[model samples]
Target: MTNFTLSDLESIVATRAAASRDESYTARLKEKGVAHVAKKLGEESVETIIALVSEDEERVISESADMLYHLLVALHLKNIPVASVLTELARRTSMTGLAEKASRTPQASGGRQED
Candidate 1:
């Protein structure tokens, strides 16, 4: 099996995002900006959830790939590196799930939750 990783995907995303929009779907999608990328991400997320609920392993895998690709695109648009996300995940792993959840400060409004 190939030892591909998120880091590898991130590299690919970076490259494709820089290509001419006429030649690359990633560039085309990125040209549409954050709101559109986010919408695509949401759609992929729903599809992934549906695949998971139906218990079709192949569909779940495929949809998950789609979801993650969209997520990377969104992150790229925001100038956030995948390593930052990996670092946050690693930090969360140091604490129990309950502890991590409890440690988060509740937002005052409908603000984004802190990671």
Candidate 2:
């Protein structure tokens, strides 16, 4: 069995983003801009949620894969490296969830208000 990591998937998606649009769905999505890519990610998220609600483990796995792919595409569109996300996750791991949430300085735009 081969081990597949998010880094591996990110690299593959990056290559696809560079491929001819006619030859790569990833490239086509990138050409459509961030709004389109975000919409695709949202759709995949709904599908994954539906699959989970229906208790279909296989479908959940499939939709989760689609969601992750769309997420990676969105990240690439914004030039945000996967390592940055991982670093944030690692940092969060150092604190309890509630403590982490409490520590965050909410943005003025629809973010949590100061206590």
Q: What C-alpha lDDT, on a 0 to 100 scale, does residue 88 get in candidate 1?
A: 90
| lDDT tens readout by residue for model 1, 12-89 | 999999999988999999999999999999999999999999868999999999999999999999999999999998
> How does each model score on lDDT?
0.92, 0.92
TM-score of each: 0.91, 0.91
Give the CA lDDT, 0 to 100, for residue 31 in model 2.
97
Model 1 stretches astray by more than 4 angstroms = 108-115
As a whole number from 0 to 100, the lDDT of residue 18 in candidate 1 is 99
Backbone N/Cα/C clashes per model: 0, 0
* Pairs with backbone N, CA or C atoms under 3 Å apart (clashes), candidate 1: none
Error of 2 at 15 (Å): 0.4
RMSD of 1: 2.8
Q: Candidate 2's residue-wise lDDT over 18-60, tens digit each?
A: 9999999999999999999999999999999999998578899
